[model samples]
Target: MFFSFWNSVVFIIICLILFIRFDTSDSGANNLHLFDANNAAEMFGNDVFFEILDPEVLRYTYRARPAKDFGVTFNETFYQREALLVPVEPPDSCGWPKNAHEIEGNIALVERGDCSFLSKTIRAQEVGAIAVIIADRRLVVDDDFYIEMIDDKTERTPQIPAAFLLGINGHMIRKTLKELDMRYAVVNIPLNITFVSFHEMNQPPWMIW
Candidate 1:
């Protein structure tokens, strides 16, 4: 009995050591913590990626965190949508966008600020946007960093799905559009990169590894 107990304890200690090593491994670090490949989809709120398809100059993928309480929650297993990524006039989208005509029937890319995330999403929805992607206004050095876009405390609820994109990724996308004198970029939102290996991902050139 004593020998069996000792063996069990030794096995548990080995398992713990292996788990710790795997958790902090180099490959794990590259997968981004919020969407770690080894973790379950529910562990990270079923996070997803936005993949640019048109204007080859900007064909890359970026992470997005979908809202938990409003609209449709993205499913990593099967959810996917292709749409034109249009920028809202006045950018902040605190009020209705002047480019409502352009915003209608496409994904509105609004800058983060001047209003709650839900407010921005609602403004885009009013213009007939199928979905909303609110990009961070301030750029953080960490490429994997992003904000959890939660709903605002109000009776007015948006009916469309929304997600948050990192500031640097947002800036790069907008800058590419400006340089190309374009109004929108064709994109596949919430592209499932859950099982995709880090090296196989079509990550932007600016993204490190």
Candidate 2:
């Protein structure tokens, strides 16, 4: 049940999504609409924090604008690999283990810095990772609090999918390891994305609570 993170968790993000199951015209539509808004309304607020089951740290799930047919219907559970919090050396080099045997066939949770997104992913993939989750280690901007990641922007896209979680969540993961008597965690993450209006998201911050 152990998923490695930076010195990291099994990172099971059980992404709970009930908004799409109910119809907009249905009685629950009013409430379910709010569910939709919470997950997808990054401009107003980013997705809520999810609990990791085993090594137990808060997880952040992310969604991206789908591009045509290539779009993944995040409604399905995706990336169920046992999370391996792969280590990054100082000066920001990923693939610290360097040995593929240690990380083959698992999701590598890597913190963002010291290298291009491609290098981190490509190295992990070369070793044998099923997917990659890039956790931000620093706050570069307000949006850094959200699940965000950028591809290399090359003509070629990775065979695997890579996404980001906020820096706050990353710190939480680290804290859990230091304070708790745990080794790592495993997670199942489901993704949800929907359109949100500025008006719906403009309520007072207290009202959001």
Candidate 3:
């Protein structure tokens, strides 16, 4: 029994030493890093912004990505009325809504499935929506959805500001669609929208010690 206990102690000591050695080297914790500016040139010219769509005292900060043709970094604070999710049919998954006329000068709320994000945003833009909000399909996207980078290489970027909304916030706005007629209510059916820019457009999350 004594021999067995001594062997276990030695094994643990060796493990601790190995762990400390590896952790201090390149192959261990030191190798982990944040994903900042993977391709410098590609992301250097782009600008990420924040959108304030809330009317209450608490304003939610939503990251905004500009389309390729969106041009240089600029900030604007404006209000837009949000509308219901449009239905996309077969033959290219392009969406259309019955109230397309109402969306002309308003923001379009589209679900994050059934079609490509660009397709949804393009449809909303074609119908004359100033901005498109792609709601996260999952009830609550645990990670930061805004950190995702938009690839506008092959596919053409949507002209209107295409913003992604996490499930919780997106669903809340979606729920207001049911009360479209209740204009005076706290949340507007076609909710007011705002777009503003900030620094640090391509900073990635840190994943190391």
Candidate 4:
């Protein structure tokens, strides 16, 4: 009877050791988190990236035409303005500005060309933009802006809350608001983003070979 008891204790110790190793090694192995449009706000406190699942997160739309075409005469006004604009000659690796730390609280005007929509969002998050607006570099006429999150392996789960906007639409909104002498309205995004864990197997594995 004593020998059997000792054997059970040894088994428990081995199991404990295996559990610790597995848990540490597979940090994000089974860590799949999902969040929707409405509940995204709740995930602000958490460190994990809040994935926005709705197209409505993309609010504004704009045209890719030149500012002069819209009868805006001041060139300096466009450059010095706080509004985000997609560059005509976007960089090969399009990302938020290198000095993006300065624009943390401000909006990120991202150029849409080389990378995926998810990449733009990640870049915006890195720079500390509360929100991101992307403009298409393609210069397609009458193009209504639409951005979609492409599911790719490189798309690491977001560590910050993010959203997408069409480049042209975002530009038009900013321009119109400025022309009307109106302050850019703050949008309160109501999202239902959350993290949850559940049991899959009937019992935890005793050992991993």
Return the top candidate by TM-score: 1
How should the candidates be ordered by TM-score, best one leading?
1, 2, 3, 4
Question: Tens digits of per-residue lDDT for model 3 on 1-209?
Answer: 99999999999999999988876875543333323333332332343333333333213433333433431222344333333233222213255766677667666656666666677767887888666655654555666334442543556655567655433555544444344532211222222122212232222121110
> What lDDT tens digits, residue by residue, belong to model 2 across residues 156-191?
455665555544555456456557744444655432
Model 1 C-alpha lDDT per residue in residues 1-209, reported as the tens digit of each score: 99999999999999999988987796676767656555333343466677888889988887777776776655544344667899888889889788899988888888888888888888888889888888865555464354567667787777788887754777788878989999999988676555666667777877652
lDDT of 1 at 35: 69
Ranking by lDDT: 1, 2, 3, 4
lDDT of 3 at 44: 25
How many residue pairs clash (N, CA or C atoms closer than 3 angstroms) in each of the candidate models, in the order given? 0, 15, 3, 16
List model 4 lDDT by residue over 113-152, tens digit each: 6776556656666666545445544433244322343434
The positional error of residue 174 in candidate 4, measured at the CA in angstroms, is 7.2
Clashing pairs in 3: 80-193, 82-190, 82-191
Off by over 4 Å in 4: 1-93, 138-147, 171-209
**Residue pairs whose backbone atoms clash in candidate 1:** none
Indicate the worst ten consecutive residues by lDDT in candidate 4.
Answer: 200-209
lDDT by candidate, in order shown: 0.77, 0.47, 0.47, 0.40
lDDT of 4: 0.40
Q: What is the lDDT of residue 118 in candidate 4?
A: 57
